[model samples]
Target: MAGDVRAASMTARAFVEDYLLWTRGQRAPSRIAGASGDVRRELVALRLRPSRGTRRGRPQITELRTDLTSPTAGRATARVIDRVLGAQYTLRLDLARGTDGWEVTDVSA
Candidate 1:
């Protein structure tokens, strides 16, 4: 017997978490499905951060929120709560539902 037939999908926040993991090199690119070409390329271009004198490590997501505008559209914002490079920056994302699942359509600082 087979399991549930429904296609498993991730929430907007979960997708963002995966994206952040990819950015930190904690997860592989293949782990993130339904991302746009540009998003994929950007992730590929990211390099690991070099350790500074501080004992602290990589940046971590402090807080995040997602607004599901519709069944097909979602907007999300993530903030780095930990101390690290670009920690002050906030990631804003626009997502849309594709044939496969929800994929990021746009990203802004």
Candidate 2:
């Protein structure tokens, strides 16, 4: 809610962010040959979706950011969903109940 991108420009920006992040981590973290493929996997993990009947000629992806919703503050486990350009994408970020604040335990995509 607080960090998600909702508008078209925001979506486009997020898409660029994910692509860049994936490419950046490819060589250092993955140590694989295909950095572009890593980018694809990262995009898919974001649960990107395009318009129906819009011709899936090209892929559309967005890198979303969101904090734990007020309602989900106390849950032991929960999946956070961020709406981007009208499509819902799961953030894959795990939150833990901390002493000071809710900290992100893990995140991918």
> Which one wins on TM-score?
1
On the 0 to 100 scale, the lDDT of residue 3 in model 1 is 15
TM-score of 2: 0.24
lDDT of each candidate versus the true structure: 0.61, 0.36
The segments of candidate 1 whose C-alpha lies over 4 angstroms from its true place after superposition are 1-10, 45-58
Error of 2 at 11 (Å): 19
Clash counts for all predictions: 0, 0
Please list the Cα RMSD from the true structure of every candidate, rounded to 1 decimal place: 6.1, 11.5
- The 10-residue segment of model 1 with minimum total lDDT is 1-10
